[model samples]
Target: MITVELTRFRVSPGLSEALLAARSAMLRDFRADRDGFLDARLVRLADDEWLDIVSWRSSADLAASRAKGGNRPGIRAFFELIGEIVSSEEGTAVEEAV
Candidate 1:
């Protein structure tokens, strides 16, 4: 299993709402994909920062999803709106819970 953590830094104060809206659209679109995407969460911090965490069955599934490009229109608009506000960084890690 793998977890992807995306960090975004926002430029303006009110941009968080827009980011959430974009994420909502993404959830609506990408929730149906196979390959054990599992689940995701969008977390808001401070005035203009967010952490988007996604769980996948494996690294291979994550790569395939990236290659497919999901939903282009919503995604493009989402990126365009929040791109400047966010400097994205991603990583994968093991999740262990006892």
Candidate 2:
């Protein structure tokens, strides 16, 4: 089953654009080469709130990636820009259309 990981967070004041740029760089330079990584998107919800949606082939793939840690330079840069994590969840996709 496909797995989707959703992470919601708020960025430090005046850092939204920096966070987005760092995320883009991380995806382009790092995540794109990872196993089972399907896609990733960063979305702005409110003035400071944001969402990170990532899709993977399976739960194992997500776990493996997590084990590797987001300690790389680009990922670390992105993480540093976040002020707080609102929520994070992972689940299998439902078959029904929205």
TM for every model, in the order presented, reads: 0.66, 0.86
Candidate 1 stretches greater than 4 Å from native = 9-11, 84-98
Q: Could you give candidate 2's per-residue lDDT for residues 4-96 as a string of tens digits?
A: 999999988888778877877688645555689988877889869999988989999988888876657776787788899999999898773
lDDT of each: 0.63, 0.82
Weakest 10 consecutive residues, lDDT, candidate 1? 81-90
Off by over 4 Å in 2: 96-98
Worst 10 residues of 2 by lDDT: 25-34
TM-score for candidate 2 = 0.86
| Number of the top-ranking candidate, with lDDT as the measure | 2
**Candidate 1: Cα lDDT at 41:** 74
